[model samples]
Target: MSDSTKQVTEHEVINYLKEHPEFFINNPGLLQQLTIGNPQGDVVSLADRKMLQLQTKNQQLAKQMKQLIANAQRSEGLMDRLFQLLTDLSMNAPKGEFVSALVGFIQKDFASDYFKLYLGDIKLSDDEVCVHYHSAQLKTLFASFNNNDAPLAGRLPAVKLKALFGDESAAQSAIVLPIGAKAAHGLLAFGSKDDQKFHPDHASDVLQKLAQILAVFFDSQAVNDGQQSQS
Candidate 1:
């Protein structure tokens, strides 16, 4: 017989035993007598070897499916918790807490690790927005840009904001969203350690809604501030 016809390896033998355990399972007489105890005869056959491999593959596939299901359920639960937290922040939090909640929303809801919240002077003549708040983590990561040097200092090209933010490999991606009651009054920027998180093609509805809410809140706050200043 050719080399291919030779007896298989020990790993194949063990694998065969696992596949069709029924082969020996039903025949207790042969199962007990065919082991190393009676290794004189042909212990395991080629058919048994193939069956074992198939069984092993099937078991592995089942394990993978189980893991996938568990992960899906976990993700769903996390989303539910996140939604609840955001709802509470929006409806019941104080004005000072709004910026913190906004940054938290970007980080937790969208998986962004770095973000900025710019609150423009509604009373200013130009469309000027300044970084009034930002994530503490982002402050640490890019300390140089936190203060007056924040992206708010320079006028940026709307078309190229993505390229500018994504250049530093570490900055990953960014977004510039306008916040205002009627027109845009502020901007929200998000960056990531993973470069793909904030691509220009990423969806904007969620962020847009966030900007709108913030604009309304800020405008209201500005009115309150003016009243207090006159008082």
Candidate 2:
């Protein structure tokens, strides 16, 4: 072929490839045709194939990410419904039934298998009902803290909670939340077993609000209980 007729560079071959819509990459014979005209054609064709493959892979990954996001959104919606149900139950339920509902809701939603709502003592040692809730598997975990122990004094980190509770233990994770002001009567221990389910930093703004509402509800319950006692 004449010097002018010969393909000189990979860029020129790439341009030629752009112009050729009929080229189908099926066999070694076609590949050879592309590479023989100029060695640059082989490099250009390989580079083109790599770029195309990367783009296709990225598109697939994007689809998977979208699906994951959608699934997460649905899960969050379900959780919202459950929280709303708990609030409704607390408001309309009979006094004893309301407390049972709150406990059952935590056990079901948090998947702790066992948990307790303790009132009148934020200091853990001051109360045994709360401790017994985790009695089957974690009695020793609280040996270090007592009612005399100040709040936040011996708090366990998320990782430590998981280790002590056992990854598979039905009540493996616990969160100690002091509701209301220091004068408030109680602390709530929210526990669960799934390691990835509850983190120390998990968002609980909604739960905090729920606790606030529960504090009010319990306060009202206490007055009624006192009235009955006097009667």
Candidate 3:
């Protein structure tokens, strides 16, 4: 027989197998010897190749599910901590002590390297709360917060951080949250030495809630002080 004739015969056999899907079922032993190259260019039996694909897919799915569970657990833990903080703040501690407690909780639980509370116009005797009267410096330093009432997370220019925190500030990443709007505007800044600790894409829901709770606390204190002064 000619080589061309042999090639045509081989092609005919392949075509016949392609047309008959049940050929493998009738000859199950042939599947053991049939080999295919995987993504790594390693030859493996047909069944082994299929099994490897399934294993890889399962590993990927497992990893994703594990990450989701870890995230959920972290969220739950944060909520619990927030509830505890709220409860602690509700005890009507002294003004200075209250500020201390707030900062203490953030530093101990939230793992923040630096925490500063900036009240735009509200006066607080507590050194923890830095009262900044509205000025061009304030506006320029927090340009990213202009007219925006949301939380911001990311790096800040060295000059801006120095202006807000201090010349000795060592934070590489930060979260800035606007407390009250309009006349009672204030800000809460949390910072960390780790650059990636706070990013624009980080979840802000919990941080926003924390800021709102603090705003209410500050506003309540202001009202109480006003009533006392009037009396």
Model 3 per-residue lDDT tens digits across residues 102-191:
666666666577777765544466454444544567666666666677777888777766766778878888888877663145677778
Q: Which candidate gets the maximum lDDT versus the true structure?
A: 3
Off by over 4 Å in 1: 1-94, 121-169, 181-184, 193-195, 226-231
TM-score of each: 0.40, 0.41, 0.60
Q: Candidate 2: lDDT of 188? A: 59
Evaluated against the true structure, the overall lDDT of model 2 is 0.54
Give the clash count for each candidate. 1, 2, 0
For model 1 the TM-score comes to 0.40
Question: Residue 43 error for model 1, in Å?
Answer: 44
Backbone-clash count (model 1): 1
Encode model 1's per-residue lDDT on 181-228: one tens digit a residue: 322354567665655665655555556666767777777776778898
TM-score of 2: 0.41
TM-score winner between candidates 1 and 3: 3
The true-versus-predicted C-alpha distance at residue 68 of model 3, in Å, is 4.2
On TM-score, the leading prediction is 3
lDDT of each: 0.56, 0.54, 0.73
Give Cα distance to truth, residue 184, candidate 3, Å.
3.7
- Model 2, range 1-231, lDDT digits (tens) per residue? 888898679898788779875565534466534422233554455545657679999999999899778667755874687667675775535655565555565555554543555455223343234332223223234433343322231235655455344455465445555445541545556666554545655545545654676676767766777899999
Which pairs clash in model 2? 125-146, 125-147
